[model samples]
Target chain A: MTLFDYIADRWDRLALQSWLHVSEVVQSTLLAAVLGVLIGVAVYRSPVGSAVATGLASTILTIPSFALLGLLIPVFGLGPTPAVVALVLYALLPITRNTIVGLAGVDPAVTDAAKGIGMGRLAVLTRVELRLAWPAILAGMRVATQMLMGIAVIAAYAKGPGLGGEVFSGLTRAGSANATNQALAGTLGVVVLALLLEGVYFFIARFTVSRGIRG
Target chain B: MSDVDVTGLSSEPGLKRADRVRLLAQPLAVLVVVGAVLVWAFARETDEIEAESIQAGVLLTKTWEHLLITVVVTAIVVGVAVPLGAMLTRRWAKPVAPVFLGIANIGQAAPALGVLVLFFLWTGWEGLWAAALPIAFYSLLPVLRNTIVGIQSVDPSLVDAARGIGMSPRSVLLRVEMPLALPMVLAGIRTSLVLAVGTATLAFFVNGGGLGELVDTGYKLNRPAVLVVGAVLAVGLALVVDWLGALAEQLLGPKGLG
Candidate 1:
């Protein structure tokens, strides 16, 4: 088949709404990103929490993704829960590190000034620091999102949803060539998602920085 | 440099070693608490595979073979990626760099296991090249990107000065740009090396030689001891690689560290 035919075939899967695989990928990504961001923010607010989370995330990053999924299965059971948990674990390092680094990057002077003007702690954080830190923080999110996009495909081992199903099915069928199409499709889908997410982050990061401070 | 001068330049807080330990304070304590809890959780599991009869001597030989594989793959990755990255950063490389980068990203995203499976089937699973090809693919992006960035980030003035001194382009690159880019390039090498080590663990799943045998064994039998041993060794290796990178940065001195 021509390359256009291949792309057209994949794009058509997106149109059908019958592509349970695409939906699974989106769901897994959203779940992982949201959880990662929330946990990342929590770690940012507390030093003890940051240290513990960093160590845990460091340890998790060391674990092979499939093996981690295998370990998660008995505890979380088959399907999205285990996979989501694994993705979230995989994502923590980038997001949490970025959150901490971004927050730390915010100038102490600016925060003190806001507080001097009687801004509350949360107000100072939200208005002054977070605004300034948004670009770096977004960069972190971009990294995590991209990393998660790639890893979600591997979550198929746990019977979790995604294009991994096609790849795995192709493998099991013993048609390595046939598997290539699925693997290729899955890879293309991930790259598209990564580029889109990175582009969005750049747009948002630029906007946030322009609005928050002078260059 | 005198110890006092070094101490003045270091941005770390002026705490003695004893004070640093003491100030480990609550964060260190919390880490210990969380670690203990995780150990308990992992230990609670009972069902697992019976221990395999692979002798310790055999396991050691296998580990040595795996390390050799990792080193060879890493060297090949660096050999290709560093030069390629330098070439990509040149004015002429603009068109091709993005394409290479896109391919690298896809390689990073796609499951290497699938790639390994495909290669094994295609090449009849004949030799170590089956494992090396996928790993070299994995190592490419970091090594390449870092090389480009590191070279590009070199102070323009340094390059100009080297040129003004009538040095050839090659000598300028080696003496000026590379020295400046060494730390960043080293960081990329470190990332690829650690990644190679981790990915090599997956090699065992494909019956390629490596410490992955232990990890795969643990996975198959659900044996926590073996799993723990495998996981710990893998993590330790990663940490050691990272430390080695840090050491390299330090040894290259302040200019490279920057």
Candidate 2:
């Protein structure tokens, strides 16, 4: 059978699971973003400390995910939890780097005015610095979300959830066209997911920055 | 005289340098501390595992092989990507650059394992070209995007001035614009190189080369030593590339003329 015919034949069976998998993957991204923000904020507060934290988080990125999963098996063990954690560790660098860069990129003149007007430190950060850094911080989130979407599938390699199962299954069967079709389909799903998430975050970024800043 | 003329006093450059040095110390110390801890932990693990000849060779030879494969693939990638990128940057070629880069981003988003599997089937792991195929494509997008951006971002007036001086378009591009655009292009190369190194290790799944041998061996047999050794070597490769890229950028100078 032709590749399209093969995929068409399997579509009914694959549809429900793909939908469920995409939902779980979406949830995973949200969880990662919330956790990542906490990590980013913690790292940003201290001057010397942020550098050390940034290095450590980035070094974590270099470690192979499978190896990390194996290492973590002793602690978190075999499921979405470990997978999400691994994805989060990998996601931290782009998010935190951008946060630091964005916060630092704020205009010093605006910061001076805020301080001169007797705003508290927290007020300066929330009302002034963060507002200016919104676009950059959003850009960072866009990158992180895109990265995690692909990674979530690879998390499937360790037997976690999402479309990677199809891809991995295809590899095991040794040249079956059905398997090949499935793998390609799953990969397409991931690309679509990535683009959708990117568009959403981009729109949100525009809204946030526009509303937060005067001009 | 009584006002002390504070505005005329120069700031201390030495003190400024000292303060910068102090600011950098904590991060350097943290990196050293982390490296030492990782080494100690791995050493302890290695001691627990009985070493064999293959394992012994894996520690040294595999790393060298992985590095070799990584360099070869990256060189091939740069060779193809630079010309393609340059061609895509021309005004007439503008619309098509995104099509190429979009395909590249898809290539990137596709997990390395998936590509390796697909390539393995498409070309039965029987030759070097099979391994090079996916890696070269995977590294293309950043190089291509950076080249287009780098070239297009060049000061238009500078190109005009070179033209005004009667330099050939080729000479202007080669001597004037290319040098000016080199830093951004190099930045893309740096990213591509580090990524190729990490991704090349995934080639172990298809028995392609070097450090991935350790990665595969460790995973299949549950040997942490091989895995750690492989991973450490991979990371060390990235660090070396990063440092080398930094050195190249510095030597090339902020001017990019070098």
Candidate 3:
């Protein structure tokens, strides 16, 4: 069958799968951003704590996606649970590291001035330091998002959702009719999705970062 | 002759002898821990397999094969990225550099597995080079960008001084620019090497034969021991490779800038 024919035949299912893929990426990245930021904030205040946090995340980053997914299968017993877990763990390094750098990078004088204005710790953090650090944090999330887009493909090995399953299925069916098409479609889907996300990030960055600091 | 203050030029933070030893021991510690795990695991799994000899061979051969793929690919990436990167940074090539960088960015942006599988399918020739070539392509970005950045960031006055002494452009680049860029170039290589180690595992998909086969098969067969051992070994190898890069950085990074 021609590639177009295959897509036509599989369009509905492909659409569902594509949606699943995007949702999975969104859920995973959001969760990772939250947790990674918390970890960064918790540790960034102390040099030793930041070091340990960075070290732990870096160690986790070294583990191959294939192996990490494989290792998780038995523990999490496959499907989205293990896939999301591994993605979260993998995503942590960039986000956490970026968070620590971003927050700590806020000018001390700026923060002190904010504090001197009677802004409580929470107000200053939420309104001042975090605002200055938002761009860096977003940049980290971007890296994590892109990294996981590739990695989530491996999640298919654990029976997780995403275009990866389609690709893996095509790979396993390699000499079969239209298998290459299937694989190509899946691979293209992932790359396009990743680029689109980047586009979205650019849009967000334009609006989210204040004009003063956009430079 | 570079007069770059090679002393104190080194950016690696100074370390006491004891601290250096402790840092260096990290991989050794990983080795010990992994060895113990292997013993316990193999001891437990001996009952499942027919012969101890086969398991040992499988482990060693897979590891060697994986290392071979990684090294060959990373070397190829360095060979290509450095020279190509240098050329793009040349005066005549300024306008075209962004195009090359964009291509490199796509190579990096594409999922590595997709790149590998796509190449495998296109070539339809399974084995080392087929897999190695695509991975090398994927990993070329870091070295290329670092080489460009390193060269561009070199002190212009030094290049000027060399040229003032009647040195050829090539001589000036080799003597002044390249040396200044060495640290960043090496750093790029280090990143590529670490990435290559991780990406090599997917070579199994193309039937190029590597540690991934062990992990993949172990998973399919529900042999957790084989899976764990394979995963641990890959992680260990990655850590070892990363440490080696760090060591190279420490020893070879601009010297005497201390």
Candidate 4:
């Protein structure tokens, strides 16, 4: 069968896989963003704290996804639990580092102005600092999403939902007539989804970024 | 400040206190963790299945395979990307640099496992080359992008100064541009090395045996000890490799720049 014919036949299954893939990645990215922003806020004021946070995050990033999954499987067992945990851990580094960088990059003068205007410290932070740092935080989410899209495939080996199942099935079913098509579908599906999300990020930046601070 | 910088390449001029602490701590941590894991695994009473895969010789071979794949992939990435990046940054090649980078960026977006599996099926080749080639492709972007950025970031006045001093274009490139770019290039290579080591774990899927084989063996046979050992060792190896990359970045760059 032609590649197109194969995809057409499996369109329903493929579509479901694609949705699951995007859903998990988006969920993980959002979770990481919330936690990361908190960590960034807590640590951005102190140089030592910032260094430690980024250092720890980067070290986590250095661990292989497969290994991390392997380690998690023993504790979490084989399912989406292990998958999500692994994804969250992997997603943490980028989001956390970016959050710290973004918050630190915020001008103290702006915070001072907010204070002069009778804003409380929390108000200054939530209204002024995080607002200004939003772009950087969003960019971090974008990167984390792109990364998790690929990684979610590996997570599929642990029985996580996604197109990676197709790839694994293809590997196991090598030499079958449809194996190539299955793997190609999974691989290409990821690339396409990644590109689509890239566009979504562009639109997000356009709409969400304040005009005054937009660059 | 591009996608490459997402890896958090250190652009600081000199080793700071934190860098020093991390440099000393990373390898030491890896050693302690790996050593403790090995001792624990060995000290455990293993059944036949666990014993089969968790033997000393077997672990060593798997680790060697993993290291070999990492080394081979790193070699290819450096050899291909550095020269190509340098070429792309030249005056005549400037227009097409973005094209190359664009292609690589898309390549990066693809899953590493997909790349490895796809390459395996495409060529009908198995083992080391199958694993290394696609991984090299996957990890190439960091170094390639860094090299171009590194060379392009060189101040034009420095080049002009070199030329005015009667230095040949070749010497100017070899001496001034390359030395200035070395730190960036090395930082890129460090990122690439970490990436290569991490991805090499997937090499087992293509029958290119690595620590991942141990992971597979443990998972398939339901041996938690074997599985944890495999996972920890892989993590330990990556940390050590990254530490070495950090060391190289510290030591290998032109001394005057630091």
User: Which of the numbered candidates is closest to the native, going by highest TM-score?
Assistant: 4
Off by over 4 Å in 3: A1-5, B1-29, B50-54, B256-258
For candidate 1, what is the DockQ-based docking class? acceptable
- Top DockQ prediction, candidate number: 4
On the 0 to 100 scale, the lDDT of residue A1 in model 1 is: 60
lDDT of 1 by residue, A1-215 (tens): 64356657766663332245445544554565566556666666666565565555554564556556656666686787877888777766655555555676677898889999999988997788767766655565566666666566667766877666655565555544445555455555555656666677667666667453635
User: Per-prediction DockQ scores?
Assistant: 0.29, 0.23, 0.32, 0.62
lDDT tens digits, residue span B19-100, model 3:
2443456588678967986887767635444233227788899899889999998889989999999999999999999999
lDDT of 2 at A77: 50
Per-residue lDDT tens digits of candidate 4, residues A113-175? Answer: 999999998999898999888888888899888889999999999999999999999999999
Clashes of 1: 1
Superposition-based RMSD of candidate 1 using all C-alpha atoms, in angstroms: 7.1
Model 4 complex DockQ against the native: 0.62
Candidate 1 per-residue lDDT over residues B1-258, each given as its tens digit: 011100011112321221223223324443564356336534555443423413456456656766776788788988999888888887777889889888886777656665665565555563466788777787667778778888989889989999999999888988888778876677677677766766776676446767666655665665655654554444445445444544554566445353
Interface RMSD for all numbered candidates: 9.5, 13.2, 8.3, 2.4
DockQ value of candidate 2: 0.23
**Model 2 / residue B121 / CA error / Å:** 2.8
In order of listing, the candidates' clash counts read: 1, 0, 8, 0
The candidate, 2 or 4, that scores higher on DockQ is 4
